[model samples]
Target: MSHTFSLSRVARLVGVPRSTLQRMVKEGRLTAQNGEVEMEELLRVFPDVKWEDDGEYARVEEIKKKAFAKRIFERALPDKEVLADRLFDLTHEYATAKGLLAHYEQLFEWVMHKLDDVAEAGGAPAAQAVADCKLWLRQQLAAAPREAERARGLLAEERAMRIVSVQVKVLPSGHEFFVEGSDTILEAALRAGIPLNYGCSNGNCGECRARLVAGEVKKVHPHDYVLKEADKAQGAFLMCSYTAVSDIVIEAAVAGAQDIPHQVIATRVKAVELLDERLAALHLTTPRSQRLRFLAGQRVRLKADGVEGEYYLASCPCEDRHLELHVRRDNRPFARRVFDGLRKEDPVTVEGPEGSLVINLDSRRPVIFVAWDDGFAPIKSLVQHAMSLELAEHMHLYWVAADLGHYQDNLCRSWADALDNFTYVPLWVDGGAPEVAARILDDHPDLSHTDLYAAGPAQFLQHLRDGAMARGLSPRGWHAEVLA
Candidate 1:
């Protein structure tokens, strides 16, 4: 055995509490065998301790050290429940019989052999060998029956698996969804039609970030994104890579809207209403068996006559089996067909309703909408949907077009006249001037509390976003749909 001192003795010599030495051991700053601290470890930890050469002190230290060592030896072994007391006593008796008290490894090996023999006799050699080492010791002890019972209890506990379905409550919207032990929160939410924001389904992107407002979740996979310590402290977790461990309440970054689920269906053009010389409202009728279900402000990919393009659904989803797509003449093949060649009864394949530009119908904040030209298609869908939802909040629309005629001023004026919560502002701009953006900023000087939605050309959206941020609106408070 190595020359060692009791931890209490080392602490007494070093003029510190025994708990301090224990703490160092726990922290891996120092090592201890049971309650005994090695002399070399003591010297390594504290080289500054004053040593006394007095005979009386040396005699007392030696006596205390022997007793402490004996006590540690007794306590160092595993409990009788796991390695029964009878086996411990038998080991001692065998060691005494063979005069091999110092040969602990030999005695331990013998005990293991006996356990293997008993396990083999049970006709389960393979299982016995793996679980034998500890059980063998228990079998040699007098409390073998009790120890075996305890072992069974521990084995069952370890074998038990947690596979319960957990309830996940989303904040702000109070939307509840279930996440099975196998599925992630994001996957479950998406399946449940809870529009949670997500970029990469794989954990690399941090787009699915949410706060664990209450309860626990376990990371199901490694993420390429490095989560900040501050964010972790605030209970932030990537929803794509985490599964709920218990019933949880999470505050997701995205809002939850009770909109219809998305669908892909075949439809025929009911009529082509030319609202203006440049704008064609193509009304498509879905088969009664499969009507497209979509939220307002969401776009659908329409494939017709060898051309496939995305267009926003202009009519409210309440108008089942009927779809209205506002197509403007941009000289694109799809636009040309809609304005000139496309006729009634033409077959149209509508796919999707993707995009997360829907309203936070629950938010009580005032809403501001900015749309330019044909971008008003989705904005019109949104306004009508909001009115249908009876959103009791104030709403303002700022429609910008090249001229008064292109602004769709009549439709906006009608809404303004009918809805008490709606306001309309028609802005005429040539090629999106900086003054038009400045005028919007001038109108809403403090946009801090407003939920602003902007849909236009990329440059126009960027300008409005930059101007709004500079004016006081948070980036989180700004939502955009850039028409390319």
Candidate 2:
């Protein structure tokens, strides 16, 4: 029997993005049956993939670590109990395969004995036929197939992946992520940039309650919220408390912009990084027990020293407990405080993550991001979010700066350098908004199959939208936010 792997698992085993596999399938370069690839087919498709050397996999992991701004311990193993359960499952599968092989061997011996009996009863012709059959069987059994070596390597690599990290597929939303190390399902989901609804991440409010649809889960944390008997029978468990022992499917709610509640978190300033004279990046750390939950490209109200202002988030939500915002050197109270005297450990309150401009998580099409001046803040967040999800086929960033002068030029360049599918083009606003829009839109003649997110002044957005629409961009493909 041939083994099969899910598309996501195959991506991991072959050290490529899932989007690459999907593209191959679409282009008819690869065959997938019901979203699974057979081992032979996978080997045939990626003949040159070196299973023993995980260089590509390591590179991807490093990119994800930097993109999400989360520290990933490469050597961290799964929880002890989960590891034991996985080993037990693997052992059971091994035993079953061994038993089947033994049964096949016995059947082969019996057939040989029956053939001998027929040869003795019949004559010289029957004996010769039996001898030929026996020789063929022995020859086949003695010979190793051409794919044997590669198959062994592939299996070994996949087995290691299974023991180290298990994939979790959330129902309804179809979001998938891998639970690595000692991370619970919720932790893994959040780390992957999937906004699953949860309050009190330590399992107190039961807001993260979900039902297991398949596979097994082990409780790694105690929860104060008690489930009713009926609910328990239906496999109800808090996502915050359980870790997956195998590839799992669970029904859970994925939060949208409207679904997330308004939160007021008292965060402490971690640093005030001045990118230039005009712009500063305020780094804040939320309380351990009260992490702020907001989608990428959202704006939040920041309050410090009895003054508050609304600014777009400059950081991805996958960065647990850490939040980043860009403040321009204006007369705004919050911006003034940020540039003048914001110090480490100073209390700053964050509230109302208020904005609808966010990443379209479901889209797998190429994405184009346009930002004007400090609008790069929210655009940066969305880009990092898309990177963490690994859903975009390609990402193009066009930064049009007037006074700020591409403040984070090195970061943008790093993204383009590290990722094959990322492109960065910085433009100067010498000829006004329309000219900048023209320069950006000139590169993308056909926006029919792309999703474009732009943040800038109202005039720039209007000019860009008109040009994008003229170039076959759909109305639904356009997402814009006006920033002064």
Candidate 3:
């Protein structure tokens, strides 16, 4: 006869959520009849389920019942040597002595009876035989701890010889992934093809912030993002900065549909032109089957001719199967190649469509965009995407650069001239200016109902954020992404 259990009971026994069991059933990993499941299938699905002593005893009883039949006299049992060996094996398998003793009490009694039977009827007394058995039992008990310790040492050695992996479960979404010893949770999730919200990967933006529901993790790196103390106290951590030490559950904000399903594709450069001496626009086309799907304002990792770097998508997603990237000719080798050496029809590997800078279409609040230098790349994409949405909310853009000539004022002015809901302002500030924040605050004194997005130098963005907070801007409403 086989033991059986219900789906809910199996879920409880395996320590997984009932919904997960349901999903397994839907996926055809499990089968049920009237909500009942066979014990064999349950064990097969989760082979690592640590059975308690009572559970082990029940299993043993089932095994014995299947192996034997009742008789008029008592059935012959295993010899003392066999019974003692089984008891030793049980002790080695179980972590606690209480459970082992409860499960093997009958076997122990049989061993004691065998010792008493060793004495002849007249030669040795039953009391002496009992005393000898007790003495032998005491000796075995005295060595039990040492034997357990030796067994643990062997187990530890075995573990050290193999790579260890820990399970991480993301809440709300119920996405699960395994993090190996050397990988961060964010890295593991991405490797497992799970899309998680993250930015700067170095832990500066707090975009990958998650709350730890349970389990231990060690911080792998330090983050400069100023997380609220209240959030810190409640177990918020940067997924990119921590590695799991044990199985863990984290409550991470799930990314929107538009923000996920990232991929790496080989794209052909359709055209390349110098926007100016410092900036070049590269047009790329993906293969018909591998057209990239990405939100406007996201960034991609571009690799060509042994050079790789991250560049923002300057074009709108409305432009199908094509991507436009604005590359700045900086001291970096990748930038130099893109600006001076790369040509049309060159094969470039593009990875990502990442960044948490996409617009929140649900908000009806007026929008303000502040861009500095090539920070305009993402801002350009954002504006284009917003325009395609046909949003009626008034939108204004402040374009600032080191020199007035670099602001791409003409391009923005064209949008202002073409769109009814758009306004563009260009400014040049060569050095640090206290008046920049003051001008913004003066223009938007009542920012309580506005959504302001500032992108540029880290220090400059921080300054603007501080000012925004001081002038009635809700911390949650203000969005800032630092450009390094």
Candidate with maximal TM-score: 2
| Ranking 1 against 2 by TM-score, winner | 2
lDDT of 1 at 326: 88
In candidate 1, list every pair of residues with a backbone clash: 86-141, 86-142, 87-140, 87-141
lDDT of candidate 3? 0.67
- Sequence-dependent TM-score of model 3: 0.47
Stretches off by above 4 angstroms in model 3 are 1-259, 430-433
lDDT of each: 0.67, 0.89, 0.67
RMSD of each: 26.7, 1.9, 22.8
Clashes of each: 4, 0, 0
lDDT of 1 by residue, 58-173 (tens): 43334333312211111122222213332444456557856764576678778777766776677776655647567656567646564345434332321221123446778877
Q: Give the winner by lDDT: 1 or 2.
A: 2
Ranking by lDDT: 2, 3, 1
Using all chains and alpha carbons, the TM-scores for the candidates as numbered come to 0.47, 0.95, 0.47
Off by over 4 Å in 2: 69-75
Worst 10 residues of 1 by lDDT: 67-76
How many pairs of residues collide in model 2? 0
